[model samples]
Target: MIVAEVVRSGFVESVHHGIVALTVGKSFGDVDSPFFPRSSNKPLQTVGLLNAGLVPREEADLALMSGSHDGEPFHIERVRAMLAAAGLGPEALRCPADLPLGEAARNAWLRGGGEAEPILMNCSGKHAGMLATCVVNGWPLESYLEVGHPLQKALADAVSRLAGEPIAAFGVDGCGAPIFAISPMGLARAFQRLVEAEPGTPERRVADAMRAHPALVAGTGTEDTVLMTAIPGLLVKKGADGVAAAALPGLGAVALKISDGATRARVPVLLEALRRLGAETPEIPEVVLGGGRPVGEVRAVW
Candidate 1:
């Protein structure tokens, strides 16, 4: 699908092609194509942690468990707390060491002469949650990332059950955890289930945590944070490789995958999907800059 076009100074300079699926009684593109949800699957995985007897000391911890945090101070502090509560440490994390994912946070870390570390990885919260779950179940921390491990099996079951579809396949994610491939519509179905599920249910708790702590899900000044903050009762998460999934409590769910994996194209397309679902969102334009000034913008035409 012709999802978005980059217009520079009233001229089309480039375009982004992708698939967008929304449950607003209208559809566009091939919503049935199977793809990895990436970090977008974290919430469902966190639900799996809860089901496996992983009791967090704080409700805010649940937010971190579902987050792809920016490695900001608060984010790192929670991650350490989660691990400490489990008697583990950053050395136990299996995700590759990396700097913060947020622009501002990363800049600050570098300015402080910081180097990449395991706990600083964007996925550390998820990893820490996984480790804590492992401790609760007596599972091996070193093998938690293995697909055959009990933790991974539980996560697979949760993702499948919530998405209402069996996994088409499995692949290693950037964070070293097993990733599931599901249809875009299936992903949308899962997110819808989260928001619409009854209060106190695992799914609803995950949704509530994300909506309540949108900044933890991504970071300050990021699109996911901005969108979730501005749109009431909306839950959104970004996945790597241009994947994103979101649900509005009373509206519907939407999922998309940009064919070229371009980050800039995802939000405009997502905003369009939200608008289709009758969501009132803030004006978030993808300004195209030429010589440090606004030249044009990326517009969604899907």
Candidate 2:
């Protein structure tokens, strides 16, 4: 489906094709087809961690455990804290080292003469949380990222049970953790369940933590953080490869994947989906500039 359009100089120069799943009316594409949800799976995996006996010293730590955090200074501090609390170190992380995920942080890192390190990876928070779970269970921290590991198995079960659908496939994520494939519809269903689950349940704990610490879940000025912060009781998570999922406590839920993997199209389409279910969303700009002036914009075409 052509879900969004890019205009430049008052012309429709391009369009974004994608699949969208909504809890309300008609879906835009093949919602039944399976695809990797990427970091959007973090919250589900966090629930699995809690179920596996992982406990954080502070409830806010759960937000980082389920976050795809920008590699900001605060983010680094928290990841290190999580690891130190588990009697581990940055060496325990298996995710590839990378520059900070946000442009401002990346620039600051370069100015500070910093090199890429595992602790600086955007997913290190999650990897650190995984290590903490292993410590709690005396599981082999070295093999923690293996798909066959007990932790991963429990995560798979959690994802399956929450989605009310069996995992269609399994693969390694960009963060080196096990990623499960499920339908877009299933992803939406899983997010809805998280928001609606009773308080103190593992599911609700994940939702509440993310909602309460939106900045930890992403970073300052990011989409997920902005959405969750601006709209009370809303949950949002974006994944690599153009996948994003969101849910309102009572309104509805949506999941989408842009076929061309364009992140720019995500917010417009997501807002459009939410509007279809009668959500009031902040107006995030998607302007196209030409010769240092605004010329056109990206808008959801549905």
Candidate 3:
């Protein structure tokens, strides 16, 4: 199936086109396709921190561990604090630094004459959290992102188990960490286990933390933070390249992949999924391209 449109307004005022594959019922689209889950796997991989005895039973830390923050000052400070607690520093990170998300940080960076600060990098938090895990586990700090590392192996295994499928492919993520691939259904299943893990398990702790501190889970104005906060019992995460997944503790899970790689379609698809499950929101989410430019709208394409 192909999803597309000819936009006549806003940023997409010209001819706007895209494609989305549709698989309903028992059908699975390209079950073994090599597609990257990107940051969507953070919550599942966070189990490594718990399993390796790095986490000290702090919900906020767990949430931060699974987060892809917006690089706000508070977010940067918390990441630094995590590293400090673990006796590590910014020099320990393997992820490359870049400007933060949103206009505030961008404007700040511009004001600083287009200089890149490690704290302004969005993945700094994830990298810092990984470094802390290494500190607590006594693993070598060098090449922590390597697949050969014990921590990486443990994380891969956890992903395999939770996904209930062997990883079909692998690649490096933007943050210099290994990325795993699984079908959309497999991704959904992984999230299901993460949210429904037995009490006292690392997965459960991760889910609980994310649910409790939704704000900390992402940042001030992120989709994961907003959706999870607005909808109780739901844990949502948005990954790179228009991938997103959400799970309800006892209910089912939903995973979406935008074929054209438009991130704007993600939240709207999530809202549709939620509404279909008998959940309602005060306002329908609007899909905007180029930030506030209405390229297309997300309606029931089914």
Candidate 4:
């Protein structure tokens, strides 16, 4: 579908195309195409950690474990706490060192003469949870990112079960963890199940924590944070490589992938899908800007 179009001075300059999969009381689109879910798979992976006997003192920690956090001070402190509980440190994290994902935090780090650190990586909380899970299960921590590791096997099982489909393929993600490929339908189904899980269950716990602490899940002004704030009870996650997914309890779920890997295109498609599902959404500007001014709009024309 031509999901969005770019115009410059009354001239159509570009178009963004993508596929959207939505499930309310019914399913829509070519949702069975296999694609990598990336960090969208974190919530399910945290379920695996919970199933493997990981129990953090603070429930909010569970949300962080499932987050692609912005690496703000709050996020960093929580990750440090998780590592401390496991008697581990930043050195144990498998994700590569990087500055905070939030611009403000990154600037502050630079201003303070900081260097990239593994704990500051967006996926650090996830790795910390993995290490804690290993500690709880008496498993090896050094090679936890390996596909054949018991931790990975457990996460795969959780993902497959929640997705209601077996993984079609696997690849190494940017953070050095195994990424599973599943259909968009499978991704939506997983998120749907996540929000609908029984109260106090691991799935619901993760969802509740995320919904309650949306900032920890992403950061200020981020898509996930903004969307969650605007729509109550809405669960949203954005993954790398132009992937995004959302689920609202009792309403529906939506998942999309921009074939050309344009991150900006994902939101319009998602909002369109939500509108189709009869859910209320705030107005989202579709205009594209140039030279600090509106040059054109990105409109959905499926």
State the lDDT of candidate 4 residue by residue for 225-275, as single tens digits: 888899889998999977888999988788888778888777777787788
lDDT agreement of model 1 with the native: 0.89
Q: What is the per-residue lDDT of model 3 for residues 56-146, given as tens digits with 9 covering 90 to 100?
A: 5356877877888777777777878888888878778778767777577677768878766665676676677677778777888997899
Cα error, candidate 3, residue 274 (Å): 2.5
Tens-digit per-residue lDDT, 1-302, candidate 1 = 69999998889888999988787766677888789989888898989998888888877788888878888998998899889999987899999989998888899999999999999999999999999989988988888999999999999999999988899999999988999999888889999999999999888888998898888888888778888889899899889889999999889999999999999999999998998899888889999888999989999987
The alpha-carbon RMSD values of the candidates against the true structure, listed in the order shown, are 1.0, 1.0, 3.4, 1.4
Q: Estimate each model's TM-score.
A: 0.98, 0.98, 0.87, 0.96
TM-score of candidate 3 versus the correct structure, residues matched by position: 0.87
Against the true structure, candidate 2 reaches a TM-score of 0.98
Tell me the tens digit of each residue's lDDT in model 2 across 96-179. Answer: 989999899999999999999988888898898889999999899889889999989988999999888999999999878889
Report clash pairs, candidate 1: none
**Candidate 4 segments whose C-alpha is farther than 4 A from its true place:** 25-29
Regions of model 2 farther than 4 Å from truth? none
Error of 2 at 200 (Å): 0.7
Number of colliding residue pairs in each model:
0, 0, 0, 0
